[model samples]
Target: MAHVGVVGPSSADQRELDDAESLGQGLAQRGHVVVCGGLGGVMAAVSRGAAQSGGVVVGLLPGTDRSAANPHVTVTIPTGLGELRNALLVRSCDVVVSVGGSWGTLSEVALAVRTGVPVVALRGWPLPGDPAMHAVDSVGEALRTVDALVRTDD
Candidate 1:
């Protein structure tokens, strides 16, 4: 029922990829939309999962060509802003779920926190200054947290 951003490294290990895929599937099966960077790594995995589950996927790409987007993306938006497109991805989400670590993913998390959009992280930035951004254990917990956070009027 919500558009969730899935952010993480463009190159990650197999476990992270699996986790991200599961998260995407879970979100999709629950009728939520998946949004991501639209390239490779976690982005591709999540997109694939969502697509396989018959869920919609929106990829905010960083280049001028939609060809760079993952094949599973239902909708691709090429921003031509490169990394700066990270801001757009965060801003467009109802909530963000970060799968693994990277400067890019951290930036997305920081933007989401600053902009009042809640983040359900898996294995990303370790923000000691922001304990509130710490990750929960599983994909289900992440989605549950996101649902709980977004449902609040605050």
Candidate 2:
């Protein structure tokens, strides 16, 4: 199964969380694994959705303490790398999906694109001028984009 990383605001609004959850559920239903930062807001919501759909959810945490991770995370990877942990999150996934993100999420998207991983931006986010990157308006479209760009051999 493909691993899809979700990057978004930790303190996003309800709509953003809803979008994240939708995307997570879509990915999970398609048998794709979900990966995230594992805090509250978007990350927590996505983990919840993925777990509920019987999909494995992995959290690439920023610190050593597993207490900060969401309960839905099936695997908690404590990097202790703080913000630099973003690189790990992006690299661990076969496809990257950004849902109503902030600066940190933007950074993750940038890194994923630079590393040649397929990236799908939900809603609207500034990209690093890569033609391989895709921008979609909804969760369904995001999932479709991910499925299309996924490199199975990798």
Whole-model Cα lDDT of every candidate shown, in order: 0.87, 0.86
* TM-scores for all predictions: 0.93, 0.93
1-154 per-residue lDDT for model 2 (tens digits):
7888999988999988999888888889989989899888999999989988988999888899998999999999888999988998888888888888688888888888889877889885765567758988988888878877764434
> How far off is residue 60 in model 1, in Å?
0.4
Looking at model 1, residue 61 earns an lDDT score of 93
Model 1: per-residue Cα lDDT over 1-154, one tens digit each: 7888999998999998998898889889988889999999999999999999999999999999999998999999998998899999988888889997888888899988898777888866677555346488777788788778667623
User: Which segments of model 1 are wrong by more than 4 Å?
Assistant: 129-134
Give per-residue lDDT, candidate 2, residue 88: 86
Evaluated at residue 149, the lDDT of candidate 2 is 75
- CA shift at 15, candidate 2, in angstroms? 1.2
Best by lDDT: 1
